[model samples]
Target: MSDTFSPRTLGILGGGQLAQMLALAAIPLGVRVVALEPDPQAGARLCAEHLCVPYTDPAGLARLAKCDAVTLEFENVPLEALDFLEGRVPVRPGRGLLAHSKHRAREKEGLRAAGAGTADFAVIEAESDLAGALAQLGGQGILKTSELGYDGKGQRRVQSDAELRAAWDDLGRVPCVLEGLVPFTREVSLGVARTASGNLAFGPLVENVHRDGILRTSVYTGGDQRAEAQAREIARAVAEAWGLEGLMTLEFFELPGGELLVNEVAPRVHNSGHLTQDGGGVSQFAAQVRAVLGLPLQGWKPPLPTAMVNVVGVDGLDGQALEPDWGAIDALPGTQIHLYHKAHRQGRKLGHVNLTAPDAETLRSRLAELERLIP
Candidate 1:
């Protein structure tokens, strides 16, 4: 805390949970955050100043350009908006990496170009492209829109031509990528933060479990030397290639026997990394704000090993208040809960619980109990 601090303003492009957390982290550092989002009720509204305009609003962009720097919570920011901001203010992770992460096909190409392995794939821009894409991908593949897809949406599994066609139709036949589904035993993600000056901080390679394609739990058990090393190497390569600053997360499919293939990348804070906030050390949100502002970034190692379980609402629930008993969560040993302060909806990520323990087995046992309690 000895470093000299200055009051500064940071502009954020989205007002979702990630931006909300970033605003919370910035408040302690004497930095102010302003967020642009179309939704007036966005999660970040509680923590930051809101510009309730579309991402590309000229007045909004002009106002945002006045901040000391700019960053985004999600990858779907329009390229024109970045171009506008890039000409006026500093945009962390910059246009190159954002462009790469926004499109699935382009992202995979960038990953492979950065020396990370990925699923074999081909683009399916139309129905006529489906047959050749399937044949090339070996008769079965996952069809996903090349853009604006997240949280298990806009993607489907297809093992036959009829299903592929149906899946594409279901997805509105948008520009898509048909990928050979990875055969893997585990899915994991690594989050890394890099400063504008090129110093890097890598989070642990945590194991992830998903339900219906949305992450439900992320556990940090540690001690996978092979996977850890691979994740770091790929992170370094991609950061170096794209001249990355701020945070970028690499999600990987860990094949049996410790081999890892890149699955996806998010150029901002990620859901899987939420455990970083409660691990008895500096959180990823603070690290991201530091990185983009060219401040010194502390290493990612947290004091207590921890795990997180998402608080996801079930279907048929929207506009309903989840007035759960916080006393119950507070009573649990070494447990903390984070609620997004938003209304509930089916399959929506409302918050997460972080559980800490002295060792992996104890942490896992606590995590299971926490999951059941939250549901």
Candidate 2:
């Protein structure tokens, strides 16, 4: 919490590309990162010191508690694990934020309570609640599990009572939320970082394109002053309302009338913000590290139009077949490629490329060329 701080240790609770990137960002600041993850092959292990243990392992938690502060890469980390580390060491954007964001019902409630616009939704605890909830949502809705849903997993679109029943049964009859679908023009996300002292920094509003519910590309499209202001306002409000002390991302559905409806919240660095690494003055990972350490936030918009494309593993391909043509991608101008050291699996994120150009047309041309070369 001091301005005159020196190199220190930081703890991360998950080990994915997000954690890996966070670790990489912290390196230049002289901060050492220790990541606790059960997977030995976790990409984060490439940069940070690895604990290599279950998150529930007491010894692992104890090791994490010894660090200067703790944070998480993914929102799905157990609340109990966070609770255990709460007072022992600083846990920025703590358990309360995690709990609120992890459950679909609670996240929507929090958004409503904050006076933020969100789609109409109802909680469904049983099959009987499905029809009524769908009816409340105007007969078409997305049935999503209350927890552990991501990238289109644990969700089903239902327009009929029969489909609703099947969706409920398919999801193991768990508690769910039936949300009305928004007639959105495009999906944009705002990434904001805040410190315990309330200092804030925002990344550019990114327009995202998704394939099979997985984010395919995030393009920096911030020339619209009105829309940009609204997006930043929504992000700041959510951060303050949640008393957040680290990075948080708000995914919004921009309506045809220019109204923004909060769609989801990720209580940590988000995939949509991946372009920040090359596009923004301060990357989300760097801002997160600064915030958790109680340092002042610093950032500015990118000088050029930038686009990020996710390299996802193709379905029905083994690890060898899933290998991308990295050589070809690296040949493009003003392009930065990041490959996460992860084993190839169906639909898994393998890497991403950040492309920057003097103008949107040039960026689009480069992206099209890259797409053709990707295997």
Candidate 3:
């Protein structure tokens, strides 16, 4: 691996909060970022040189190609665009992982190929296939679009043949994957960073809670010896199998019998990892930047127990009508807040707060206090 210590330019394909955080992490390392996004008001534009153009725009791709190393903030970036930039500039984690992650079917296949266990699933090509797919998965399953789905979107739960047909129709008869629901006790996610030189760093295994299929909170699980070992092994195997050059997150289901099944893979920095920013010495964004630049990777150890609470836009409350008491939140000890400056809508991720405590009891107390503060 080559050293990139001399003022390097990093290119990011999407300009959302992830890219914004990455840009902030790169500043102290003397690394500059060029973000390609259609929105001129993207959060990343606050820190990086923004190329205000669509992902597929020729001029935008050309400008991104000039960076020393490029990475994507979101998986939905056009594969063709990454293909165009592959040889022109080094795109970390590469397009192979991107292609696998961009679609649900391909992602499941990639996991099975790596010898990882996943929920039994089948493909739904058309409405006609829904009934048979449902039968194959035992009459109850989730029908998800094969591509471009996130945060509970592009998914439908069907318990009967009639419901299956309706869901297929509702999803526009697009290519989809039908996965049997697993009766799991809880959800956990692990983030791993691997460099080109094969150095690896693992973030704390976090227990996740979701509401309406969107991540609501992630608590750092520090002392679960068995679960932590298994989770780390799964993450490491997947990263090594894909030969990942940057960061990726593996979300898993913890069954009642103490088995971990792979749920999904995000081939970039993940939302569940937001706690790393304040809980530990190295944040996920910083680790990603170092990995992409071929810098040495370092392990993360949380200095205190922490929990991250996601602040979602309230239903029936317009962005203009919602006003949070920031002063009250800031007054709380060991709390750090980060608000993504974006137009708010119902169920949208507006920001997150990281609360740290000396132990688990105080952490739970802080979480309860935070719940009362959110509007």
Query: What C-alpha lDDT do the candidate models reach, one value each?
Result: 0.86, 0.87, 0.87
C-alpha RMSD of candidate 1: 2.2
Residue-level lDDT for 133 in candidate 3: 77
Question: Mind giving the per-residue lDDT tens digits that candidate 3 earns over 181-299?
Answer: 99999999888999888999988888899989999889884766789889888888888888898999899999999899999999888999888899857888898998898887886
lDDT tens digits by residue: candidate 1, 196-299: 87899888788899998899899887766688888999988988887798898999999987788999999987888888888888888888898888887886
Instruction: Report the error of model 2 at residue 221, Å.
Output: 3.7
lDDT of 1: 0.86
How much does candidate 3 score in TM-score?
0.95
Off by over 4 Å in 2: 1-3, 315-323
Off by over 4 Å in 3: 1-4, 316-320
- As for candidate 1, its clashing pairs are none
Clashing pairs in 2: none
Error of 3 at 315 (Å): 3.8
